[model samples]
Target: MKQQILFSFSLFLLTFSSFYYPINTASTAPASSPKLAPAPKSPSPASSKPLVPTLPDTSDSTTPDDITKILKKAKTFAILTRLLKTTEIVDNLNSQLITAKSGGLTIFAPDDSAFSNLKPGFLNSLNENKKIELLQFHILPQFVDSNNFDSLSNPVETVAGKDPLKLPFNVESLGNSVNISTGVVNATVTGVVYQDNKLAIYRLDKVLLPLDFFPSKVHASAPVAAKAPKADDHKDKSSSAEDNEDGETTQGQKKSGAVSFITIEGTRTMLVSLGVAFVAVAMI
Candidate 1:
């Protein structure tokens, strides 16, 4: 019975040892690590470029106003444009527009047809100074609108002259029509050529002929014939000539008498000298 008990216990011990050793070895083994994500790619210095700045556009800005350009665009003011350039009034008007105190100017521009209506050689007949004055006569230092024609006084002043008698003109309004009179010629404002806050231009049917160019015609009688010279007048003129001749003769006689007196005095002087020499010789 004792032998049987010992064998059974030994069998139990062997089984327990085998089971515990295998479990411990499994727990001590190393575990597998998780994989790392790849680093993000960086751009190369040679391929990368700095951003450049851009400038704003200025092409949309408004351009300056030009008088010649305006007239040229109108196409009907060719002759007037030529006159303006020849007289250099376009420059004056532009400069005045810049420095104007009243902030405006009014121009009574004559069209090509208006110039054609003038007499032949009319423009050529005017001297340089007259051409300038003719141009200035059409311009007013102040701006005047079509509606304000009645507000202006009669015989309105212009750039041509300050004296009312020289380049004097009258502005009269007949409802919608405006008439300008210079006592020499009457013209009506046909239409407005251009208008702005700084400048106003109007069309004229006829050139405003100032009194300095054309005066009122007056009939005159024939000049009185010179009164025939009277016989007494001729006699008086002849007597005056005879008296002048006598005066000349009297002057000649006085000169001759003075010459004789001088000769006699010179002879006396010579005689005295001779007498002095004779006395000296006798003393010796």
Candidate 2:
């Protein structure tokens, strides 16, 4: 009976040992294998942002030529327009009209009839730089109507005159009429040729000659006058011969060397002068 009990116990022990320690299978993973990295997350729909606002566009708006268009319509202002063109201030005027932080522009323009009274060849006598200064004299960088005269701080300098020191201008207002003085010539506002918030144009019977250009007096002795004729005659004879000899040379040189500054109004002072004369004749 003891032998039978021992044999049964031994069989049960063997079966338990085989079940606990089974043989390794081919599909089993190794303990030392490297782990895979996680995938990157996609951007969310809520991450999109709105577009930023931009500045106002001025590309299609009114330009500086708008002033010229208005000025060209007025026949009496032909001389002023011509001078402005000569100095290349028409473009500057247009630019300042747009860019000026303070007053846009104020122009005290003289009529063709006013220029007609000047000494012959007066305009022709001036050099290029003098012509620019002359044109600059007529312009007040800030826009001022006749009503703003009393408020203006004088001696208000101009854009041209302000380089070394301000080309000073004085304004005095009485009733509806305004008088402007440049310490040399006095001009009264005869009419308002053009007026806007950005610009003001006042017609003057006389040109506003800056003290920078013209003097109040000229001093010459009688002897100098007598001697001038002989010297001038000598200069003229020599100049004529030199002109004939150097005409071609100077012409080509002037064409090549001289900086050509044409204006937006076209280079036609002679034509403008003729137009002014035509208008004046028609008025007569």
Q: Whole-model Cα lDDT per candidate? A: 0.76, 0.69
Which segments of candidate 2 are over 4 A away from where they belong? 1-64, 162-166, 215-284
> What overall lDDT, based on C-alpha atoms, would model 1 receive against the true structure?
0.76
Candidate 2, 46-137: lDDT as tens digits? 51222112112212234444556666766677887877776777887887777776768888778888888787998899899888888778
Candidate 2 colliding pairs: none
Leading candidate by TM-score: 1
Deviation in angstroms for 281 in model 2?
Answer: 99
lDDT tens digits, residues 170-232, model 1?
A: 887766678888766899787776665777778788887777775432112123568998999
- List where candidate 1 sits over 4 angstroms from the true fold: 1-64, 215-284
TM-score of candidate 2 relative to the true fold: 0.50
Residue 190, candidate 1: C-alpha displacement in angstroms: 0.9
Q: What C-alpha lDDT, on a 0 to 100 scale, does residue 87 get in candidate 2?
A: 71
